[model samples]
Target chain A: MKQARDSAPAERALFYTPESVAIDYERDLGDPGSYPHTRGTRPPNTRRETEGHDFLVRELSGEGPPSRSNEQFHYLLEHGATGLDVIGDTPTQCFMDPDHPYAQHAVGNQGVSICRGSDFVALYEGIPLDRVSCDHSLPGGFAAAGLFLAAETHGHLPELLRGSAILPPLFAEDTGYSSNLPIELHMRLATDSIEFCSERMPKFHAFVEDTYYISDGSVGIVDEMALGFVELREVVRRLVARGLDVDLFAPRIALLVNCRMDFFAEIAKIRASRRIYARMMRDEFGAKDPRSLAINVAAHTSGATMTSRQIGNNIARGAIQSVALYLAGVRAMEISAFDEAIRTPSREAHIVGLGTQHVVQLESGIADVSDPLGGSWYVESLTDEIETKITDRIAEIEALGDVVELAENGYFRAIFTEAMVDRSREVVDGTRPVVGVNINEIPPERDTLLRDLLENRIAPCYDRIEEIAAWRASRDMGPVVTALDNLERLCRDGSNIMPGIVEAMRSEASMGESIGVLRECYGRPYDPMGCVERPR
Target chain B: MTPTTRLRVLITVLGLDQHEAGALAVSRLLRDGGAEVIYAGRFQLPETIATTAIDEDVDVVGISAHSWEVLHYAEELALRLGQADPPIPIVVGGSVITAADQVEILSKGIDATVLPTAPEEEIIATFYRLAEARRPRL
Candidate 1:
């Protein structure tokens, strides 16, 4: 039989790897402390603080609605996690308070439920405000809606307090976000957030999640990802022109990313981002402050791959993801736990998650050298190739029109469908090994870890859920009602919703009410403006 | 017959879940073995899924999940299908679904719980096995 041709090189799949992507493993170009930022994001200083737990520890939410996610907050602090990344429940992140009807089903699925000053204060009970570094992945829902919810809790946005508040408006609208507000109107509010954050909070990172490039079902070319950054760069320049100190805000503008476990592909993404952002910051935006040019990033493990079967397998997966992100040159990082695929990570799961980082950061010696793979022939070549692919995809999207147009046209949807089709085939075949999932025949070892949560009959965090639910029920309804009305007015009138959300929170509005108001204001999901076609 | 008039088959993976690779491959194998596929993207809810299958009038449903919580959910979903007098064939796949989960699943009235390591040919063979097991018995 004649041999068939190998199709990898032709499809440009060769560049999507770790061996080709992870560079410079052998040489020590610089110590961990070097300024050019190669030997890990920081220097090799064995600060005792970074030793005991994760170099960066984020707290899980707490037991009360009016209560804060303080249980884990205090734990992270007492346990020596220097920086804290706290997640607000969906209600708060969406600028809603707990009592809103929209929030009934989603109170504490992801994190803590914070509605007002008291909740924020309580959440931060033991943790000092100034010392903790927080990343609030709140989207404004087509307007700068969730910013204030974060502000009341964190004492002020970090970027703004540090004189670098550059809150970029949410642009990747394909995450099922279709607002009743006009695109131009949304643009105004986003820029408003940039302006507001620039002046008020120091060290704040007004940003957009970058997982779309690597994760979202929308699989655009590498160019589309780069172009998204480019468009964002333009948004920054537009702000600079409007007299927001471009240097301060733009520099503090960080990229929220998901480091997919495709190890080298992720490494290449970071290098591309830095090189791309550096050029954009220095040359395009003319950002002179070293802070402005610095490309800071916060990464999560790919949510897509976080699975439910053989839950313990996610630990190794999370570790691989962390190693990938750190390799990609992120200064600070957070890791999801092995149990992440199951539900909100248990306290023990969170600790092991933090421990995973410690193992990688301290024990594995990964952070001992700078972009260790930077100079490698395979890595550099792949990095360049990834940049090319990303750039091409961005242009393709642009040619089709802006992100909104691509979204409206389902261009993004089509790409993801195709990607899914391809991946589903891999799973059906034996091409990819998911360990205990697919290839490995063994069951979890007896002490695989988390004896109680893994082996025993621990109940679902249902008690935690019920606690927040009851708190929402007990709160005064009058003020929350009024807050929702004001927020609705803001949403309807094309006004920036961030301030209104904060105002509502101050009134003890629960997250649900706040989010409900906006959902009503934005109306239901999406009404295809031009499809007009009859249903099948 | 209207192209949509035929019974539909929904194959999806839900939650912070994404691992279309194996399922994608399995989907093609099933297609070759003669099954219509309604491939919903990741993070589909149970209600949404049930509604899709009902609306599509699918005779067989195959769902994939990666995380432990989702696998447990998948099992519950599969078990629930038997209650629908005209039961739909349910098959589950993903990295997490294992030989043990498969056995527990069979007892729940699920036809099959496909392992990620199984060959495509085995998936086809199993697909037919389940289909035969589910043959109309008026």
Candidate 2:
């Protein structure tokens, strides 16, 4: 009975043993802050002294218009939040202004909506661009240029601005739906940002591969690892082909992967990711900088795993995921609030989410030892297994020619569709029982807790007609037209479009106007009101 | 009744919420369960969602959400569908909506509400029940 119970097989392996896994300490596990860095990218507790802090507790935030987000940012900063992760709304991300018909209902619904550089200035008002690090979660492209223009508006030097502009995959949503712009156009914008950041903003990360989006597509952990690396490699290839060295920008790029409820598997996934990145940067890409070898990882707690049945239990889920992120030695992390399953997290929920991190950091002592489980037989063995799986998956993707081509053709999308269906079936069929959902099922009376929570939720506020009227009436038309013409010329010539974008932003050109210039240059139809019909 | 006739279901997202995992999963599940599925994609307005349902002649419209936007948009969608020439059955599902909220949305003309963890049988039954109920009007 003991043997049967102990030998139960996991998803990858049938059984576990040091000899069976063939673990060699020198070859497989290296010291902390050393090559391979399986133990961690740094020794335990050194990050606090060297970086003046451990991981930055940056909460993913933003909603309503720029002024609203600015106030929210101040509130968060006043409440112990160390950094900013601005979430741009759909219209801002798709390069549409609030005035667009398609954007009317969506403005300020998910995140802060901005139409030009001035919106960004207002969004970060009074927050010193030079002092505080920020991350802008912009979906489309050219957000880096937008941020640069915003900083410049405040008389901040381009070189002194810090933080990142996360280039979400070319596609807006992760459901394999059609993107606002085609793949090539998205690449052009991304490459433009990379080149501009490499030259002007040395401290800024022009792009970060967000595997959180990959996981949102319902792909498994191994697939997330494989696709994230492929994305970074593709970006590097594009940059290097443009005559930029690998080390010049690779150090600035980072990875923001998902942290699922699978504690040990998630730990192994993150650990293996670092090792793989180190090897690829050093050997394949011929990177010399040690900073380039060290992959900066940020983890977003899994929203998919949150149970709506008993939402209160989600705090425990977040705590478990936070531990996984911290144990894996992530540079930054965000925990989804318990109420995330029911609505936009309330202020109390945000406090609780941040408090959970504090508990793990202060009381739990989980962050005291870097990669505390690094040498454990099980963790080490699982790390090796996950690394092999990730490499194998990438090899399969490489056989399909360029990853971008494959992605455009729906190769990765098909995988996620299938994985999502299968996982849902497992849950529905009770083969994989979620605690508060499938088992221990209990429906609260009247659902007063959730109802009260909903009462506290504020609907996003935006008046498109009025706001657009005021904005258009204020900006000087001559400079806007000249800047847009210059942008079109740069786009037509295939020159880096970042400088032109910054110029256009400086002239108070709205996002739609900037995108319109590019569309005209490409001879593509300009319709901010257009929707990409979901292809069957 | 035609022997090969299949129930056509339309799944979509509304407002600014971009969570597609639940929507995509439901699409696949319904597809595998022998229903023809049409995904309208995410960030669509309530008007667009209603127009698509009418254009596609879908038997049931399923809206997915992951934020409070769903509460407002789903209600609007439900009202729109109710006002259609031949009102279509509407089902709203997601992780964030509570039972009381579901009741409120249902009262606003949504035909059914499915939780993220709802079983396949319950989902299928709700769709068929609502679709069948709307057949006489059609």
Candidate 3:
């Protein structure tokens, strides 16, 4: 670790001595890719030169069947997008068959509707697995399978295979999906997933702790929404102690926290998050591996921060989030388009969004220097101070009985409600200007069709699944049930449920049975007794 | 002479994934409506619907479903009510039936398809109207 300038103030502050500025860089600033891993986490000098071209934004889930997602992937890649983010159909996430009664609701909400291993093979099709990073980020029924296949296809199964696939947490608390499932069951399933990955896909990460959620059914917020990443640390700790080897899992367990409008705060979040995670993993859990402490941001340009009112104002919002990304040490970004609130991303919007990142990477000369905010007294001080705040916050959650209990009680949800109210009041009262919602006298309506088209397009997948249902009825049910039976046995004994699940998947067991096995293990649904008095 | 108006609400659990989060979130919406909600949990049967609505004598029976296959149970529940000496007004919600699907559901005597992940206020307001429209028929 080298120090250029630690005592000088590049920027002055009004609120408090720039907290990020106060960091003891002499003590913490490590090399770009080393342990204590403060400066940067990825391989040294891996920052790609910002492309002059942009990702050709294309709508997923219509016209072409999802089995052919790679066509769309290649098209977008050829056109502009540097990476791919997949949205699988309902059956896969819920662990049901396309024909299952549970999946008939929303088959292909946004991305491709994945079914089994065959669907996964087709989804990736020709996309090179090792070249560009793919974010089939969220994990559910078939998510891990998608990753395993991708890893294997590349023929690079290094003994310790690790990467990110967004995974299920004990949902239903707020995703509006997991609310009905028993929290314990969901927790157990998540735990089982972590256990499974630790043994085989050692180089791969199992959980994303994504807080993007079905939030506001509207806009997005920062990492605070991600099950309180601070508290989620305990989830990792508990799993580590369960004999799965904490040090090995630490390198793989990364967070995909959100970056909202509070720019400096977002910066502090990234810097402070590193220190917080490092100390927690090292101090609390006694984790020796340094990578486990890294905080990776699956940076989504704020959805809530965007304005449908002005329509064009969202571009500015996207830029603000993009700059925040650089300051925040963002690992990967899913920059939102200009009209995100009006509708989904259009070609112009996506290009503009990706272009924003390109501009940052190329013109700003920010990535050339590691830890660009390394010596800012404000950034450093805030890094250390916020490290305390976030750590204390996480400790508060742990006091309530780890991740499962705290989530069941809506601890973070309650805090979020209060924060939203405070933030919303500022927007409404003119203390803060939204440019579209409260500030603009007349809100724009250019993209109502986009919303309607999305609503309208999702209908047919429901009707099509009827055929799958009939076909599934005749596939031998014995293997499906038996695989699930093994899953139950393994889960009850605290053995990793992944192998059993993989076996079931091989046997062509429907996703529903996978979830059923999980529910059986965790016990059928539990309803919380107290109402957390917060939220709109 | 006085006239009373009822609220019409369409609530459903959207998507083929039987996430009970909708059931509870919908329940909050229903409770806010001040109407006796015919609460149906995951994996509901046709009879569960008929019996609960009959027992509660509610103004609106809001059903939650995550998939289309199961929404038929909701429709059958609605149909069972309609085939009776008098039919009850049924509204839908969840990812199961979007606004586009609302028309198909309405053809079966359903009043609405509650949009997926509607907030409590919107869900409640929709029900207030749905209950009013169905009250006369019931």
| Best of the candidates, lDDT | 2
Whole-model alpha-carbon lDDT for candidate 2: 0.75
Model 2 chain A: ten consecutive residues of lowest lDDT = A1-10
lDDT of residue A352 for candidate 1: 75
Runs with alpha carbons beyond 4 Å of true place in candidate 2:
A1-9, A12-17, A20-27, A43-53, A170-179, A446-451, A519-523, A528-536, B1-5, B15-17, B43-52, B67-85, B115-118, B136-138
Scanning candidate 3 chain B in windows of ten residues, the lowest lDDT window is B1-10
**lDDT tens digits, residues A1-536, model 1?**
00111112234543434555544433222343332333333444543534522345443334334343566666766765656665544444444444433344445555666654456556555545555654544334312233334444656544433211222233333342222333444455566566556555545555543454344433422533554574575567567767667776765576656665567767766666555665566676777776665566666666446555556667788889888866766755667666654455677777877777777887777765557776765656656666666555545555764554554466654555556665555443556556555666455454244434533222223444565558666877777677778877887886666677667767766544454455445553322222111111
DockQ score of each predicted structure, in the order shown: 0.23, 0.48, 0.20
Cα lDDT of model 3 by residue, B12-31, tens digit? 33334344444655554454
lDDT by residue (tens digit), candidate 3, A1-536 = 00111111223355455433534444576665555556656544544555322221222222124554667677667765666776555445544455544445556543456655545656666766655556654335346655665456556462434345665464444553443456666666567666667766665557666655533332223235324464366567668667667776777666665666767667766766566566667877788666666655556656656654455666677777777777666667777666554343455555677677767766877656667776666666655555555555555555667566666787655554444444544554676666646554442234342344333233437544764656566678777667767877887887767777677667666555565556655655211212111110
Highest TM-score model number: 2
Candidate 2, TM-score vs. the true structure?
0.90
What TM-score should be assigned to candidate 1? Answer: 0.72
Query: What is the lDDT for A535 in model 3?
Result: 10
Docking class for candidate 2: acceptable
Cα TM-score of candidate 3: 0.74
- Model 3, global lDDT: 0.56
